[model samples]
Target chain A: MSEQLATVTGLYGLLAEFREPEQVVAAARAARSAGYRRLDAYSPQPVEGLAEAIGHRTSRVALLVLVGGVVGCLSGFALQYWTMGVAYPINVAGRPLNSWPAWVPVMFELTVLCGALAAVLGMLGLNGLPMPYHPLFHVRRFEAATRNRFFLCIEARDPLFDREATQSFLERQKPLEVYEVPW
Target chain B: MTPPDHVATQAAAHSSVQPPDAPPPVLEPGHTLSTVTDKISSIVLTAPPPRSWYFGLAISFALVMLLMWTITQLLWRGVGIWGINIPVGWGFDIVNFVWWIGIGHAGTLISAILLLLRQTWRTSINRFAEAMTLFAVACAGLYPLLHMGRPWFFYWLIPYPNTMGLWPQFRSPLVWDVFAVSTYASVSLLFWYVGLIPDLATLRDRSRHRLGRKVYGMLAMGWRGSALHWHRYETAYLLLAGLATPLVISVHTVVSFDFAVGQVPGWHTTIFPPYFVAGAIFSGFAMVVTLAVPLRAVYGLQDFITERHLDNMAKIMLATGWIVAYGYAMEAFLSWYSGSPPEEYVLVNRMFGPYRYQYWALLACNIAVPQLMWSRTVRRTGWMLFIVSILINVGMWQERYIIVVTSLHRDFLPSSWGMYHGTKWDWSMFAGTIGLFLALLFVFLRLLPMISIFEMRTLVEEEKHVHGGHSDTSDPRGPAP
Candidate 1:
């Protein structure tokens, strides 16, 4: 129901193309300052501070990694304790059933294993990847986004968006070309 | 392979600039973002592999066949088919395992440690180094599983519940090794895959082949280089690097614990953990040199993997070699300082026993030979470093052999002592694993972008920005279409 306007508009966004990364970044910052929301910028390589310019704050990736590491730590120790001390106790050299020293290596390994997995997987999930079909790919020149060019896209879903106003605004930003992202 | 310095001189001859005293560029100059992407991705996308690649892979594949045959025979017959016997139960199998595992350390050091240290130069070699780590670990893993005698029941090492009411002995260092090694391999893979994603996307986008595009696209997980995605990816990559640093250290330490925890006079050393880790890095860099020299030459990638990279890697090998040499000195010093007759004999017997020649050879190869690296000229000369790296590889293997065989063959009881020798099966198994390692590496080079394309692009941008070269718009390829 909410995307009904977008459906009527028959578009994803207006993409502004630029030769230099600084151009796209500045344009994205300008659009955001002019009260545009739901925008993204793409570049051939990571452009420093571009995400922030496009209305994203600090990413949750690190926090999620921290949570994953904690979960791995607790579970790793729990598995060892339950297996060794509670479930199948083995008395060796008169040591206690719950010998924590012996558990360190496996626990450490699991913490790292689970933590590393979390870092990669969490980043992927947050990014909404495996999205093989994206409207941006429809722009033939958009292929250059992964090569040598940079782009700023202003989605039609933004409240401030108007077909004419947005296109003209993107043009005013001095893009090489402003593309209508036909959905 | 054309010598790297020769390539460097040629590239320099082409450029004909830069003051004499200035440091060599990590990446050769004249690369724009597009140019860097094109050069790297073209290898996977357009450039046909050279004939030498095929010839090398054919040899490696044949060796892989040899490995398969060796494994089949071992499984059919039993542990008895090999020469491992009473005193030297752990011969080529354990020695090769340690050597291969140690060889993986430099990759982790290059990828995770160098990344953390902000070593921008690592960008060119990190991808293949990480891949090398995965393959080396794979090769190392085979020896232990095959040596288990009953390879089919190898799952018994895992700490899972069973009807028989058995659990892995948690206290054993062997059990700890199981956890450590598996964790290291998986983490290394994840790290490698995560690193590869952006480059895979470049391959996907650049690929004209239908099948290649689909395969790379799936692996890339639709990475479109959105600023948001790169932000998350950078964070995740940094976090993984942080976790991998300690994990790499712990892996070798755990491997060393397998010997240190044992009561064998020579094996039970206090310095084993640090010494083993040092030796691991030493051998690992040697292997990296062995791989990198040919890689740059065959692919004409001297522009990316410059002489500076070679010089830096050689410097690291020299530094770690000194650490290993110090470990040898301390180990001998402790032997006499303890005044323990058996411990002292272990050292003396290593020098005077039947295997005394191997001990001196080990010293000469590991200790004396690498001393050539002290010369700046030798370190920069590609072939000399290559020879040194090979010798170090051999010397490190002999160190492990001596540590495992020499100590076990002549234990406390003189009457119980017996000479041990590796049968053909042992040598075949060792050579076979090398084949397996090389075959995996060959396939990786052919299929994937050996250098990270996006990272190289980023490095170019950073270099440009640092020198205020960003506004200069004379791209040889011209503005993107």
Candidate 2:
């Protein structure tokens, strides 16, 4: 069963370690130029131009927040209007049933509330987070990526992925080491 | 590998690119990325609690017990247990409520607003400040519930489905508060949690104990430092900050509305929104300093929470303290200029009324003591700043007491006017919340990475960029167009 599982997951990628962010970035750029599209880089901290080099820049979280905010704003106003104007219309100082002024505070609160919620949830969803398992965790040295090292991984799923060629290509970038990441 | 001296030279050259007026160093000198991770994570992951932590915890837990006793007595007796009367309906309860809520603002300002402004110094303090916001808000939240008289019926504030088919009065600022405070607490929690993720991952990775790793791993949600993940994380964080910025402004404005909407001479003022917001930030920064000064000492976190952090925080307190001073001046000016006999009377009463000492004390602490912060020596001296912070907090509490009690104790109808004096219950509840806040803080320090490891790592990386010509490849998003 374990062997079957390994075959199913197989060798997911060739992971390369670079001593510096510049090295990994240059390697990413080089790989991109070499027409490798299914590549990702990791660094201890954000390295400029690396994301663009590996080509995964745009995020929809902002747009999601906007939608959430609009929904919240409308819902907030609607809730107040439905309750005060329509549902239970009690006269308070002869004020109009549709008291738009009083509704503003709750509306603003909900807008911020929903917008923030969507931002966090959208980020996690887009990143596919809460994912405890990844093929890279199987690599003993991959932990350094969170500490000080830089890494670039070319996934086996890439149409152009040939293990030997990918390994040789990564080696030419003068990376610290290269290893296969097993799923 | 590059020679260590060469790397140093590059970093020194990079420092030149920083604007001459750039703020003081965030992290102490000579910290490598590995060392930074080790130092911060070690506090939670490895080190045993110091004697001070236990001493502080014991005191805090005692206070928590006192708080529980007070609540039990109050619940058994009633709101009569408080010093609040018909004329002074909102006494220490409302005073502490507003004071705590105000103290929460600095955290959001530091974490959300400073992040938006690209102030890197915030990195050092944001984690701590955000945690402060949550705990402070927790303390603030207890007041309105307890003050409701029927604390269990607090759910009536929500517009939930009911057999009577009733809804919370949307027109009331009290109801507005229900939304504002809850939303503020929720968003702050989310913002704090989201910020903790990467740091939690750091802790998860660094923990040698099986239990520590498992706990941190669950909290980290399997973060693997993927660039793609960081990209989305940054965007979400920026969005949350943007959302929270308006919130920090709005929450206090709504809190102010609780008074401003009233017809009382002192309570109804156009300036309340900005005035209250400034006071909130003022008190909140002071509270941050009060917590941070001792915390840095006890934990030996000077390397990360650095002298620069205290200096900058003191400067913030001074700036906001001026704003608060301005608020006082404006309130008095508006009262006199308007020539409303009642407004003029209220202002005069605040100056010479029965609680006149409190008003003066407020000025002494909030306005006068903070003036010392103008001198660089006072701002740089941690103990001096700590003392000033304590004074500011006292002054702020007095400010709220004056606002709530002075305004309510004497209204337009002199016949109904009555003075307020806090009972033991009032002091107990206040002291209890303080204990609860401290106890929660102690636990937080023991478990979480109080200093944001990833952000400090980023700061280190940026510094390296300066020295190494690594700036070119530092931000993939490219230089701002």
Candidate 3:
């Protein structure tokens, strides 16, 4: 608990605000090249190159949704087969008990349902959302990151992070302002 | 620093590729990111509700109360209160069910299908259109539940373990409808909510009031516009759009199966699936235009929901309208060509039967009225399109009525055949659902950013690119030099 508390209260990052998305992307690339592995960028809208600059390229959401769809499809068909073919089977014109054609629509619906559920749940899980508290929220001006400003932050947890050195490096990118984000 | 003269020359050269009157700008003039945030957010966060809003809300609330009253009486009485009987077992309830569900198709088409196709104009209208889908589905859902008479036993539709050891018949189209409609509602709600998160975060940040900030903050779900979040967000959004695109085709096809799987002459045709899908989109676009015209005028949002958006939507309606017209022609031609007396008789009855006027009116409203859109002027004129949309809405409803009642009323045995006329209860229920739809819409406009703020910002970015400004030249995953 004490270790966790120490981590929580520790210095979070040094944040630099840039006037343009290009500057943020350039700064992120510079920070990555300078051996800072734990870094992030924020902008009013998606800046094309910022994700790659921060080295976040691939996501597992599609794979999760595909797995969900397959599961949903199998389960849906299985449930119908069990109910119709085994439990309380009423002979409807002596048709086959396991009517696969009859099972397609429900299976399709369930596939979509699970696929959609996976999309939302996987996205939230991957993004770590509903976290109302974060160290970055400590900076009042950071709110503008959702409006007009662009920001790049280098985390203190990075092996090469030194408060003074990181501050100087971000300053070299010619940002509008630099601030230490506190826990 | 960039030279002003050089920028102007470049901008001029770019504009030269398009016709003299390049499409009206997607967004209004003089909008910086800050101004965009301020203008849209202020509508929800700061501006007082206009008197017109209050007036409309009151009327809608009154109608909703009437709906509640009718529903209460319906529960107290029974399905006997409806006009459905004899050969015409389905009445206004089914017609309205199909109508409301059809109205929702345009939203999915606009938001999901258009997004996949990379149509940027969808950004302006997708948010509100998705909301309309949710509300329309809600209204559509009310019919089947209430039409069952014992609304409390509606859970019987679900595949749950019961002491009675019964399961929903898998082969029945009615059962398929339960899955289709419910899945549509769930997916649409999630898609709408997922799209709202970023804009909600914007609302969270811009709101000055503590209570407003807290409310929007909770809804925003701690979004900070991080690049990592956007990466996952874009992926999830694309996946959902892909998933929803199939649903836009499938859900209505399943709905159409409820009729096609039957043995009735008009309902049993193989063409029902594609025909129903086309009609759904046709009516759905009409409803969008119907709602958008009044909405843009009321809110003075002519800049955001511009003439071009309406024009584009009108063009879609025109195309889909032709498809619906083709369905009608094919229905007539196939009935005659099949040489099946019962099928031929149904078509002849539809034209010259007791409901002859309705058939003609349906064609006039659905087919003839939309022909006005061939003229660019009518499509661009908001009022003209709005009136046309109202006509199409009425026509679509009558089309459903003709398909359901006319066929059922004159089925094989003349002795069992009977006419269906809507009672006051029917009108009340229909009006009530409309009231519910409108009230929900008004609340959504009041509380949410009807247009996506972040997406409109992307449009601004593109506009800057056209003007030879800081172009977004880097790939989404590549580093800047």
Candidate 4:
């Protein structure tokens, strides 16, 4: 990775790599406690408390899905009512045109449908996905972040990210490699 | 950089989590993260598939061709080509539609319902089953569309403004079917693809070919497996499972409502919804077993999809099979208890009428045969479970046929009471959907990691354990090619 970077590039941050998930967890905790507010951990699998160590301990996806479901259900019912009862009402078997009982099935379906769409899209939107180019990709060993390696990166944007001091700080935490991430 | 052998922590991460008498690990004990990734991705990235894959794909594609031919002819000739008439308005079209959709339920149950139940073993097989669900729904959706004489006017089911100021009657279960089936398909796809993103990222990183990297990269949506992202991912995934639980139960309930609302004697029973749901799970688990047995063998993935998976699935099938059997008993009792001649006649007609053999065969397939699974030997053996699953599949199809035909074949007017038999087009259409299902499955297996790689990674106690050496440049595996 270092060999591939012959041209001068701006620094994005320092990336500390670890072989095991525990090491990355420990490093992320240490970095967070040391006042690095902007940092992220990458792992091959979900570590039980890794996100908490990096300061993200709560999620709003469930609430978003709830709201989406209610809205979807109401709109579904409205659509049925407007169409069947108001817009194109045709009497059948002398039955009332406002057949609310029959509307429950479509409403239930729409609620699940819209709420699920929110669940996926909201999560992805919050995570800033489809971001094809990131500074982490510049570091070749980072590819293993999807495989077996664990990584904790202290971004340059962090208030306390001092390059030399953070390098030494990560070294003390005992990682496999501490590499400079290029922008 | 530290040396290859620093501090190791060889046994620290694992070894203490398991009790002495716990069953075998869901994943076999020795797999590390690298090996799991290697084993799953290798199907697409390294090793070519076995010759049997080509053979299966060929047959499925040919079936797809048959389906296309039948659909073409049906479209040209309208619904009249099938044996459907006034008395038997629904034949193989509705039967296959119901059967295929019912078969889809097990996948969601496995992926979403089992996940909510905190069943850890679902980690291995849920991905492919969900794929099966989507494909089955796809197959189910085609029938109702083709059944429409003017297939192009299918959009009339949707509540949209058209030139004629026409709107679909929202009070109809058929319209509800439109929304339910479409929603099921969309949500199943979302769940499946959301689960796939991280693994797709793994493939994108590991793929050696440039085109593979580009294609997988685009599909991955640039997933980096960040901790924050994983948190939101898990959050969204759990919410989806929560939503899908009721949705899956509701899907079959609505399908049964399509029949239960009818004035037909056999179709109007109140037990239809729960009975239909139970029968759905029964057939769905059977289909899962049918597919999983060969898949586990062909991939040599005994480690991931272990014997316990088969055992648990067989147990579920047994339980659901009893529910189905109970539904059958209730149907009979209700007919006699109601004391209505039409209701009693529907029951007697199913038993001794023109379709008595079909009823008996359905009993043998769904009830009598699944009873064999009570033996430990049958549940444990792959071939035996496979055989039972195939039988159950056939039995469930027969169940639908009897329900659809026997009820409609006898009306209040004996003059209109006539038997229904599927014509060539109907038979071909049914067979073609099976081909369509298999063809989609074949494509899915080739393109994606059928087993969820990231989920499998989570199963291991210590993912960081390298097999023979460390990862990265210093590894003894010769610098990762």
Candidate 5:
């Protein structure tokens, strides 16, 4: 396997967003030009063209849910059928070996349960929750993000990241301030 | 290209035109609910509905009182008053009970699950749904106690140390049902109350009378809408949502056990839990549609409870309908394929036997009618959905009847293959429960805020992503007065 190299050293995408959409767009373009592929942007909310500006396309979450849901449904049906029909069949009044009809509701519920669980847990797991520490929390004004701010982060692990060049590049985009994230 | 600062520029432009001393609150940039919410505010948001609303309420209350009277008479007379003969021990009382319980599922699903999912559309309908849940469950819970004949000794259902040395059978599904339903009710109330806290606060601030203010204030839990308070409140709410979601699943599953755990061939199926849950949601959504369509028209929440919300719920109904249909198919296939005569007999009897009309009715309402929802226009239209929802509710009730009375009516004994017919008292009691359910809901509508104000406010903030725009070089200290 080829060893992966981080493009921009130390400095990654901070995505210093403003309330105005134009400001966010302009900064995104400037970061791209500053040779910081690892850079990200932030905003209080979604701007129409923000995804394009950040050079990303689509979320993988839905695919995960679909796969998980299908797997869940199949497994659920198999488990019930295996237990009730094959493993330990209790024949009261000479009922049949495979009572498939009674399994439908449980199968359906399990599918939904699994699908929902996958959607939630997969999201959290992929996002890596309970971090308890992030450099962004150190910023006082960052608290306002929960209220009325939008932001995007391009991790230092991104191929285009560079410490000094990324910082200089972000500075040119007219951001409020760029902070280095230590992960 | 200039990013369209439609709101910001408009605000700035409007500010220049306004008198210098005018308040900034008037010029806030957000697209307030004024247009969307205001169109139907006179109709939807208005409390006490109208004189006509009260007239309906009065009728319902009267009917409920009649039901209570009937109950008193039944209690005085004995279980003999309900015409449940040998084969059909369970009658309208149990059917109505399951029907009401089935109706209750939609409320919890709409309010808790949708809220957790951050579905914005839930805002318009959740309050009403929660009220329906509380009332429907109340109606459902009355049956088993009243069905017991001597209603006074209903506490025997609850496990307690008494003068009698005998303990309640923990192993029995009936005992589990008492815990299940009661726990469901308690947890649902807690979830409902927690969700209402912010709305109650909104009502507290908005109320005209001093007593109203004080009353709502107390219920509002001294909420000031502080960030810290909201944080804790939200954390608790998420936890409760997590708890209630499973409780909702478990309650109906446990209820199914009342039959499934029995030795009856048709009743003893592993599919009871999920099948029961789906049926519960199906009946519950049907009931919601039945009530909401009329209430939406009467209360004037057309825009808020928009066609979109209706369409979504209809889709859900359609989906659950298919699930139930599949359940029926699977049951039939198994009955024949398993080569079990009794199982085959139960399935055959349900379809072509004595109570074949009920089987067809269930199929028509639960399976066939909901197929109409696949059409966008049918689902979006109020009257069409209302009719369908009503039919579905009736069908669901019949489905329970088919499951309980029909199956029990023809036990393993070939000699006792007789049908169970519901007496007039049975029909009257069912009617009475409906009246009771509606009366409670009507009262709830007048008393509580039918919408969550705090949650709505959250949507505005959520619309704006925290990671939104670029501000690369502006110094933190730089500002303008």
Candidate 6:
């Protein structure tokens, strides 16, 4: 593989979106056909076929939750065993060395604590919360994502992300307007 | 091009004042008592009562009052009037406390969790569930206060720096209950308030009387529904929902700590928290169904709280019922597996002991009976569903009693064992609590709009926006466009 450190400057990508979901889908298909890979789409709400247009599988949220729960369960068991059996083992009324029964409540509680913590932290981590900064924020009308606007963006990161080619593809979509993004 | 300009010009020509592009102004024989009553009457007249609604309400109200008077007498005389003795000091009070608290959990789940999930059907039932939660919690909060014997010094439960340099023991489960219940109530109130503001605005816009306008205007908080305001409001509501979802689970988990961390054989277990939470939600749904089934008929909100809503609540009850069943099975399994003689005995007594009837009642109500709802037809039938809900509530209450009273009745030593038989006062006090809960609910029904108007409007708006120009049959989702 020839790892050429290619650098290009003074190149900007423009994004335009159609109000109709079908039009957005058609434009996305056209862009992909036009070899634009580094693209993103935003809608006020989740559109039926937009996930396929963006070319991503199901969200990684479930994976995060699964990993969190497993880790939580393990730590819960480990912590209770360590505290009760090893740390300060007070043999109260001839209870066993590995007293699993006594450990039950704390283990359960810690499991919930860790599982809940994982959900909060995992959600934040996945969503990139407290982000305060994003290139999308630079777009004046991007605030409409929470309201009544649908949008699509083609980043300059894709191998075929040529400024002129991306702009031409978006213009053919016949959206409200096409704007250049300075990332 | 400008609709407002045309309307304004037309109003000027007619010599009648009308705000252009604004909602119609409310005008009538406004401020007088008769006018206000008339306005209320119009809404009431259109309201259709169920065939047997009056009988149900009268009975529930009567029983509730009986419970209240019983409690009042218990509070006045002393905690000694009950049959709780020796090891079984908890008896009916603690059992009732946990029972009521569990009944309160479903309300929060419907409002907060469903809101976060973007479940639109939640709008119809959420308001009544929330009101149920507040009232049930009020009922739940009482048992612990009265159970404390000297209820007046309940202020000491609040953690504070005192003149005598005393601070509450945060480590204790009872202390945790104080914080948990207080925080739950306060947050639940905030959640209810935030959801109500938009509906209040709708009421304000629709009011035709001066008192109606004044009352709703104050509640509406001068909302103009600007895009930015809606944006911020949605964000805030979502954020609050996020906060509340875990809080619901946590509050009940903490409540379970009162039992699970104890040294008692039946009480000490890992499954109690989830078990308790599940049972709470199960009972809560049953209570909501108990209230809403008749309410929709009485209030003429069949379009709002349709059979679909009843079907959903019944499904939820069934789901939670499975959880309760699983928890009970696990407890029995753990007891047998643990190889602890005392734990083994505790499980045995629970199944076939003196209070075996209570145990079977719980199993039948919380687990077996709800299975009938698996058939959609039964769930959709209001009277059938209502009967099941009432039974579930009874079973859940008895389950709590069995857990708290029966377990503690024979603790640590066999010599200290004592069977708890509630006196007449005990029964009356329990009855009194029902009355108090209903009285609060009665006032709430009259004062507030029982159904959420704003959430309904949002659903309508979303429907319109999605199918702007398409044929009704074109939409793939349920009920088409």
Name the best candidate (by DockQ).
1
What DockQ do you compute for every candidate structure? 0.83, 0.72, 0.80, 0.75, 0.02, 0.02
Global lDDT of each candidate = 0.89, 0.89, 0.90, 0.89, 0.67, 0.69
DockQ of 5: 0.02
lDDT of 5 by residue, A1-183 (tens): 001323333332354535555676666666566554554554322345555566645555565666766886687567656655655456758877576665554455455455545554554444443233455545545543432344445456655655555566666666666665532
Candidate 3 per-residue lDDT over residues B39-67, each given as its tens digit? 77888988997888899888888889999
lDDT of 1 by residue, A1-183 (tens): 326667897899899899988898899999999999889999888998899999889888988888888888888789888888888887788888888888889888888888888898899899997788899888888888888889999998888888899999999999999998888
- TM-scores, each model vs. reference: 0.95, 0.93, 0.95, 0.93, 0.66, 0.66
lDDT of 6 by residue, B207-279 (tens): 5667876776677555433222343345445655665687788778888989987989899999999999998
Q: Which run of 10 residues does model 5 chain B get worst, by summed lDDT? A: B472-481
Off by over 4 Å in 2: A1-9, B1-23, B469-481
Residue B225 accuracy (lDDT) in model 3 = 93
Per-residue lDDT of A20 in model 3: 77
- Please give the interface root mean square deviation for model 2, in Å: 1.0
Q: Which tens-of-lDDT digit does each residue in A99-149 have in candidate 4?
A: 898899999999999999999999999999888878899899999999989
Query: Which DockQ-derived CAPRI band holds candidate 3?
Result: high
lDDT of 2: 0.89
Quote the positional error of residue A30 for candidate 4 in Å: 0.5
Give every candidate's TM-score on chain A: 0.95, 0.93, 0.92, 0.92, 0.72, 0.77
Candidate 5 global lDDT:
0.67
B425 Cα displacement, candidate 6 (Å): 1.9
RMSD of 2: 5.6
Comparing 2 with 3 on TM-score, the higher-scoring candidate is 3
Of the true interface contacts, the fraction found in model 4 is 0.90
| Model 3 spans > 4 angstroms off | A1-9, B1-21, B469-481
Worst 10 residues of 6 chain A by lDDT: A1-10
